[model samples]
Target: MSRIAYVNGRYVAQRDACVNIEDRGYQFGDGIYEVVHLYDGRFIDADLHLARLERSVKEIRLGMPMPLASLKLVLAEVARRNRVSEGLLYMQVGRGVARRDHAFPNTPVPVSLVVTVRRVPPYPSSLDGWSMSAITHPDLRWARRDIKSVNLLPNVLARQAAREAGAGEAILFDPATSMVTEGAATSFWIVDAEGSIRIPPLGPTILPGCTRAAMLAEMAEHGMRAEERPFSLDELAKAREAFITSATSFVKPVLAVDGKPVGDGKPGPVARRLFEIFARHVKGAPRNALQ
Candidate 1:
């Protein structure tokens, strides 16, 4: 079956969907995007995702294409039309089409909105024996990494580098300080020797991840405290365990980094426990529970 997409306030076949060539998003990558995960036809962390979307749009100085309520309805309709029960909903808002120019168009123009949905396999029941390897790369992204912008060349390159190196992710670190920033598409976390969760503090170098926030809340609920402070590459190497969080991969364990084993070269107890806790949190809570 052909998939459907919402483009510029119209629902159309995905293949037939198109935006103007002069659209700032297409021309200069001036846009922001958000992705929400769906489980059993319900949006997981819809409120948080919407909040982040708004924040990103504001950060980029672009007007919202539609009101929040209308956007939510559009997303729901797209998901329904595509029959996406367990999948992802992606939304992109651009500065609108105008003559090819580096600066923002002088005249006011309506922001462009596009949304698409696709099915994804359910989360694994157990990462018991499964693990992912990651490679570290120099953080070469713009300073405003906090914004969820459409510009992702550096991230794309880093991810490709990881793929070529037979790894699933690339953990980016600052060249100046060697402080770990984040993954190409995921938020990084480590379990320290004292069994405490350590994550980098909010800064311009890292995007504020919704899944990372949810994981922190889950950790708190389970009586585990997370430290939000910068950890260096040396620190990560000696950490007891490590993992990454994202809208897609909830709590994935990282057994190795740069071909070196982490924590006995296996998924550790902390990561396993957190994964179970996160799974339960997502499954047991109602769609609006977080709202």
Candidate 2:
């Protein structure tokens, strides 16, 4: 089947999608993006993704190309065009084309918007009790990791380091703090010995994960308290279990970090419970406000 894409104000064949070479996102990586998961032809966390899109534009001082409601409609149409019943929808808002310069482009230029859809295989039946290897990489990213910008060279290198280490993800360690901040693409979390969920607070070092927030809500129903705190590199090996959260993978278990087993090298009970709760919610979760 031919894929479809929403480029700026129009929908076009994916193979024919194109943007100006001078688009800041292409030239200087000046843009923000979000990935919304599609399940059974329904959109998951649509509101949260839109909210984050607004936040990203605000933080970067980029004018939204259209209203949030309009964008939502467009996303739904893009999904329909692509016939993506279970997959991902990606949208990026870039600073409109302008003269090449490091400083902010002229404020009045319209922001660029592009939406693309791709298929994601069904979630595995038994991803539980899985393990992943991770090596500490220096956190040298800019001070605005909170914004979902496109400047991902640092993230690219960090993930490559993790890939080279024969691991599923890269857990970054900040040089100044000597601790774990987050994974290259997913949010990091660990089940403490006392059974509390631990994650570094959202700051310049961590992207605000939409799935992470949903997991926290799911935790309350499961009687788990999610804590927003930085975890030490040494604490990884001492945790009961570890996992990651993202729109694409949902929940991924960490069997090991740096070759050390996490919680008997299996998915912990808490992580699995949360995953089950999250899965149920995603399948039939109410509107974002209810979620």
Candidate 3:
């Protein structure tokens, strides 16, 4: 079956969906996007994702194309049309077509909205061969990363560099401060020697991740303490275990960085337990049963 996409105000074929060439998003990357993980025919953490979507439009000075309640219906319709259970729902909202000048159009134009879904493999239930290797790269994006904008050239380059280095992801750090910010596309975290869960504090340096937030809540509910503090490269090198989280990758263990083993060079106990906890949360298992 041909994939279906919700473009602007209509449901259309994904292959034929198009935005005008002068669309601000196409010309200046003047748009925001969000990816929500679909699990077992449900949108996992959807409220969080939609909340972020609302925030992104506000940050970028674009009006929401439609009310969120209406958008939710569109999301459900698109998902049903494609019959995607385990997949990603991608939404992009852009300043609609305008004349070729850089500034916002003198007259307000309708914001563009496009939503699509595609199938992906089921989320892993175990970490038994799930360890990944990563490479460190300099964080070279603009400062307003808090907004989930489509401006991702720097991330694309960094991730491509990681792929060329035979690594699964790129852990990007601030060159001047020597502090780890996040991954090319995921949120970074570490289990320190003190057995604490540490993630970089929320700010302009990183895109706050939905999965990262959910995992932190899960940890808190289970009596686990998580510290939102930045860790330097040296600290990262000495971590007991490291992992990255995102909508698609979920909770993935990182066993090595820059070709060197982190901790025992294996998926540590903490990461394995966290993975199970998050998997249970995704499956809607009772919170008390998570421990």
Candidate 4:
């Protein structure tokens, strides 16, 4: 089936969707984006995704193209038009078109909005034979990684490096501190030797991942011990297991790092259990349960 896209104020063929060349998102990368997961024709964690989009829009000093309520409707329509029952919905908001200039336009301009959807494989029911790997790379992104902006050149480069290295993801670390920040496009987590789940604290150094937050809440609901402390490269090397989370990847186990096996080079029990918890949470967890 041909894909459909919502561009600005109208729905059009995905191939025909276009924005002004002078749009700030195209010229200066002055925009934010969100990727929402669709499962069984229902949006997973819609509240969290929209909340983060709102936060990102505010941080970038860009106006929302329309009320979030209206944006949700657009996203639903886009998904429906594409006949995507299990896929990802991508949304981007830009600071609108303007004359070539570094400064914001002297006159108000309506923000640019785009929404599209694409299909993905169904969620896995087990990690019995699944294998994924990662390689360490320097975090060369800006200090405002907290914002989900479109400035992703550094991430693109890092992910490309990982691809060339025959790895599935790039685990990024601070060059100066030798501390693990996150993956190029996913939240990084580890199961330490003592069996504690560890994720780096949220700050300017990393994006506040919606999947990470939901996973943490699920863990908490089960009375699991989770720490929000930064883990160094040395600590990661010694981890019992490692994994990466994102809207699309969900809770994926990283069986190896830098070509070395992690805890027998297999998916650990902790990761499997976490994956099960997250999968169940996505299917039917209460909205208030996502604290």
Candidate 5:
């Protein structure tokens, strides 16, 4: 079966869906994107993802080419067209097509939109946790790091470094401040000895993750404390447990950083608890009654 994609107002085959070369997203990386995970044929956290989509558009001054309701319809249509019962939906919006120039186009340009769905392996059941590495790199992006923009050169390179280093994710640290911000593609967190779940607050340093927020609520329901603040890289290395969260990975525990064991070189209890709660919340089957 051929995969389908939605381009602008038209539904087309993925191979046939093409955008103009002058599209700002392609030309200048002037676009924002969102990735949402699906389970049991339902979006894991649709509302949060949608809210972030709106935030991204507002931050970048890029009008959502269509009303959000219409966009959701298009997204569902795209998911159905690709037969993606369990997978990811990727949607992007660009500043639209304009002549080859650096500045924004003067006249109103139609916001270019593309929605694609792809089948991903089922999210892990156990989430026994995975190990990752951190390769320090200069923070070389624009000041507004809060926006989910498409200019991901630094992240691409950093992820490559992690891959080559034989790690699952790359956690980046600010060289100047020596504070851990987040993973190349996920939000980082640490569970302290006091049983507090710590994640850096929203800033130019971290991409606010939807799963992370969901887990915060899950924490409260599961009888855990949530803290939003920054901690040192040293604190992370010495913390009780560490993990990263994203729309795709959900909640992946990080047992090591820079080839050193975090805590007992095993998935910490706090992270494991969050993972369990998250799974129960998204799985929607009343906690499985057994593990």
Candidate 6:
């Protein structure tokens, strides 16, 4: 079946969807985007995703293409048209098309909105022996990593580096401080020697992740308090276990980093437990329960 996409204010065939050639998102990477996971025709952590979308748009000084309520409706309609029960919904908002120049246009143009949905495999039944490898790269992104902007050249390079190295993701760190920041496309976390969950605190260096937030809440519910603090590469080398989180990857265990085995070179207890908790949360918990 042909896919459908929401372009600007219209729903059209994906092949026919197009934006102005001068759109800021295309010309200057002046835009923000969000991806929400869908399961059984229901959106998971949608409110958090939309909230983050609003934050990103505001961070870039871009106007919302439509009101929040309207945007949600549009997302639903797009998903419905695509018949995507288990998949991802992507939305992007840009500053808008204008004449070729470095600054905002003298006359404000309506922001551009694009929404698309596609199917993906269902979540794994268990992560017992499942694991992914990662390679470390120097964090070369702009200072405003907090915003989910389309400026992802550094991320693209890092991810491609990982791919070439036979790894699934790239962990980025500050070269000078040796402090771990985040993955190119996910939030990084570790289970320290003391059995405590540790993740880098929310800051300019990391995008505040919805799945990361949900995992923390689930951990708290299970009497596990995650410490929000930066850990060095040397520290990570000796960690009991490691994992990365995102809307798509969920709580994926990191078996190795830069070709070095993590923990016992297997998915550890902490990661397994969190994965189970996260899975249950997404499957049974109400959307409002997360908020």
Ten-residue stretch with the least lDDT total in model 3: 282-291
Question: Could you tell me which 10 consecutive residues in candidate 2 have the lowest summed lDDT?
Answer: 123-132
Say which prediction, candidate 5 or candidate 6, comes out ahead on TM-score: 6
| Candidate 2: clashing pairs of residues | 129-267, 131-255, 132-255
Residue-level lDDT of model 2, residues 1-291, one tens digit each, is 899999989999999999998899999988999998888887788777888889999998888889877887888899889888889899999987888888986555778999999998885556644446676688888988999998889989998988888988888888887888888888989987777789999887789999998888778777878889888877776889888889986888887888778888877787777777888888777663212
**Superposition TM-score, candidate 5 onto the true structure:** 0.94
State the weakest 10-residue window (summed lDDT) of model 6.
Answer: 282-291
How does candidate 4 fare on TM-score?
Answer: 0.97
CA RMSD per model (angstroms):
1.3, 2.0, 2.9, 1.9, 3.6, 1.5
Model 3 lDDT on a 0 to 1 scale: 0.91
- What would the TM-score be for candidate 1 when compared with the true structure? 0.97
At residue 198, give the lDDT of candidate 4.
96
* lDDT to native, each model: 0.90, 0.84, 0.91, 0.90, 0.81, 0.91
State which candidate, 1 or 2, has the greater TM-score: 1
Error of 5 at 145 (Å): 1.5
Candidate 1 deviant stretches above 4 angstroms: 287-291
lDDT of 2: 0.84
Model 5: how far is 119 from its true place, Å? 0.8
For each candidate in turn, the TM-score is 0.97, 0.94, 0.97, 0.97, 0.94, 0.97
Of candidate 1, the 10-residue stretch with the lowest lDDT total is 282-291
